[model samples]
Target: MKNLLLIFFIITLIACNQSVNKISLDIRVDGMSCSHSCAPFIKRKLIKTEGVLEAEVSYEKKLAEIVFNSSAISKEEIVKKIESIADGIYKASIIKASTKETNLKKPSSLNNRESLDFNLTKPGISHSSGFQLPNLFSLLNSILK
Candidate 1:
């Protein structure tokens, strides 16, 4: 019985480790109007990133299908790099994963109003409470006075 259980555990571990991972990413980017001209650059950059074994780009669909080692890389990293290259160019969908898990959604910015659901009191700003710095002329006048 113990031997059978051990065998099952080993099999499970192997399955998890060797599982295939593929991510479907939509790259809505500028400066890439033509696939013939830009496909190679996209492919090269993606391939350089960790765990990416293959990157296939479709010009018509503007989609990038990437096969990678999930243990080494993540969907978020890919999206971040794509966005960094040419602002707002990455939308990732995890078609498959070796671990069968999803990553937590992180806020894009600290001041994202839409995602702010925390309870907080609203404070009013007063005109008199605003910044008031004495001018150089005023300083001179005060000294003269």
Candidate 2:
């Protein structure tokens, strides 16, 4: 029974690590008229997409930053998804793409009236809140030992 429990914990930790294929993509969006409706509209659609973990759209900068699991979806598919919104009113192009080892912290719920503030500019800055999966795994490993 003890051996079985140890194996289960190891498997769980491996599975958690393998599932996170987080990719951060910066996209340039065209044809947004205002920050009020256009930005939120695009943000809502992007967040609803499968494999999309987070999306931040700014009409003032005409930029959309999205974080998703590449294993579940491709960047090209995301760009196409954007272009297909609102009867093709928006055009999207990838500005930059980078792979992230961990997920970024974001609000659990966003108000329609509130705007997202992007503060993830500095390198090596993590805004993760609460206990993360990796930390849990580490604790389990220590306990098992």
**TM-score of each model, paired residue for residue:** 0.42, 0.62
- The residue pairs in collision within model 2 are none
lDDT value for model 1: 0.50
Alpha-carbon deviation at 35 in model 1, angstroms:
1.8
**lDDT by residue for model 2 (1-145), tens:** 9999998888776657655578999999999988789988898888767667677888988998888778768999999999999999999999989986333335533322122345553789665422224335554676779
- How would you encode candidate 1's per-residue C-alpha lDDT over 1-145 as one tens digit per residue? 9999896576555444454454434444344577775655566677666556556655666666665555556777776766565455544444443433223222222122221343233466322211222233433455569
Count clashes in each candidate, considering only residues at least 3 apart in sequence or on different chains.
0, 0
Candidate 1 segments exceeding 4 Å error:
1-31, 86-145
Kindly report which residue pairs in candidate 1 clash with one another: none
